[model samples]
Target: MKKRSGAGLRARVGAIFVILAATVAVVDGCNGQNSIVGGACVTGYVACADQCVNTAVDPANCGSCDVVCPSGVACLDGLCGGPVDGSSDGSALGDGSSGDGSAGDGSFGDGGDGGCEPPFNRSSACGACDVVCVAPNSACLADPSGNFVCAPPCTPPLVECENACVDTQTDPLNCGVCGKFCPSNLCANGVCQGATPGDVVVLGHDYSSGAAGSSQAKVLTNAVFIPPSNPLRVLSYEQFADAAAVARVKSLVQSAAFGRTVVFTPSTTSADLASPTLAQSYDVVLVYDQQGGAPANLTTIGASWVTSLSDFAKAGGVIVALDGAAGQGGMPQLLTSAGLLAVGGHQTIPAGTPVAVVAPADRIGAVVASPYGVYNRSVSLQAVEPEGPNVIYVAKQLVNGTPANPVVVHKIVNP
Candidate 1:
């Protein structure tokens, strides 16, 4: 082979360098990081009709070459869409933001971040984004001010009470009006069962009052006064460690007078007491003393249980606690913890003490005659003390002819 000249060698090397540069350009362009060969198009640009174009924001070539966007729409992230910034021109792709624009401010329209697009008037996003309306009954409606809002769940002849749709004219829990519960669970044409609407009614004692024929037993039986037509569904807790106390409660509730109007269900457990669903299924919750006259078990009476009980009482459900059930770690403690009772404790009254009607003319006092005595010789009575302002002392025990220690009390937790 003939030896190459220096000028020819330099020309060959320069050609090789040009070829290598073109190869690098092709590789870089394929990787979407630089311009392609012949400098036809840069990164994020596509060759169209011998010209480079950015399809992402080009209205004339939206998403692809020659794909023109419609009028009043903007090419946004390879898609044609209307403006989300309340502009009629459709100049802005989103609300002037590149990420989720909701910001939890209950706004609507596209956020441009590929997140969920809230429906205009859906129940899950009523009136505004994330503003959920009450389910199963409510709907989104325009208010008088021309603004979208959640309409009440109730229709004509019914009203919304505590997020529930009910007929005030017939609902015992909302007799005549919302949050007006009838103690007897009876409502007739918006009227409560008893003669007085706000009268206090007391029932039951701390312990057993001897046989059913005893005067104390008769007094308690008469005080219940629930109508037979509108029977009460009672949920009784089985967590009472004392079998004797449980038996006594069963006897009292199962008596001929009480059994007729009271349907007792003794299937509640410690876990069940914490469930609001189970609590709402009954009209009354009965919690009596535990083993050795101790208060209710702290493990059973937790924060959730107390909250369920308080909510039950506020929703027209009655809570009947007996003996040490109202003592420390029991209903009193629960009430105090829930801020329903300022002070909570119990007083032990000697056996055979006389009970006097303190609030005569009240529904509870009207049921029993004054100067009554407990017939049970072995069992003593427990009187809950320092009642909240909402509580009404119906009867008190007379120790040595002096009235003291509340034996029977009544309260209607409206709040």
Candidate 2:
């Protein structure tokens, strides 16, 4: 080991520097553009002429240092093109694969167990997101990959009415509540009323469904004066009649000489007082013992019937009304309109022979007695309107001053 002076030391240091530089150059050549720490390509970018660029991210070359992006993606900042917000070229791509299950930031079947393709939810089918389903009538089938198919399977059966559904066959109001119901046996209110010659006579030839005179067709059949050969034809409208009365009328007709020639019409719905044919077709229009006269759907006989019946009476048609129809409120207005008097709050004839016409004089008489069998001195008589030259058949003096109010006022109109 020779000791050297300052000048010799300088020369030795310079030589060592040169050798180190050479060694570094050799290492760089072998490693090929890499960092000393790792064998990675150290960006592998080529400085061609002026710009520093990675040929892999350039349009000319891609993948390897010599490769580049295809036509769609362009190189930018030494890398391939980044995603655009709304580019028109239409291509699928992914930025990163950072996701969990359904809660992942990635798309619906993106990153889960087997790409999350099984257990299809009905809510997300037919290209819908976050849901899956088969449409109505579609069958659900599984694919080879265990994915559900979404489509209608087959046509469903038609709906039909069944069991305990009301029979519209006989119900006048609700004929055949459900299902196909034929007009079976001409039933009304569950009771069959067969049509006969009498039904034709009473309802008239022009009568159709829900005729007003349907009940009167039955009543005229029971009339004692109506001959079987020449039955009286009448059409009348009644709101309601007593069930017992209907049975009675039915029985009376059954007992007649003819074994039931005239039959009641099968159905009689609510009557329309507006029809004049209902008025003119009948000889006698009698609304008898009618309860619930002011029907739920109709106004009381306050104006129309009052006015029309007055016209009918003037035309010489006899209109008989019994009970509620002839009660104080209804009959008084009608009688007064027809020019007649009606009196009776509390008055009754003798239980047995209370009402009678005096013989030879054509005078009507009634003897009213108290509930205790004592005959009250005063009697009541109601004189109907349409007053013309008429005879008083029988009477009782009510007021002491006048010729005594007639207890029984029988008027002979056109007599």
What is the Cα-based lDDT of residue 409 in candidate 2?
Answer: 37
Model 2 lDDT tens row, 1-415:
6667897555444433432343233233223221111011113334333222334234444333545555554432224442221111111111134322111123221222221132332323211112223234233444466644444433222112232324444643232222212223354533323322111111110111112223222223323223222223233444554454445444544454354233333213333433344323333344433343433222334245554554443433444333322222233343333233342322323312222222124211222121111121212334432223453433333233333223333343231
What is the Å distance of residue 77 in model 2 from its true position? 99
Candidate 2 runs further than 4 Å off: 1-229, 246-274, 278-280, 294-299, 314-316, 324-350, 359-415
Question: What local lDDT score does residue 71 receive in model 1, on the 0 to 100 scale?
Answer: 64
Question: lDDT at 304 for candidate 2?
Answer: 53
Runs of candidate 1 with Cα error greater than 4 angstroms are: 1-205, 213-215, 218-229, 256-261, 278-280, 292-296, 299-302, 324-344, 375-389
lDDT values of the candidates?
0.51, 0.32
Q: Residues 237-339, candidate 1, lDDT per residue (tens digit)? A: 6564356656765676567443345667775466776776643356566665433323344433545466777666555555655443322424444434433
Cα shift from native, residue 312, model 1 (Å): 1.6
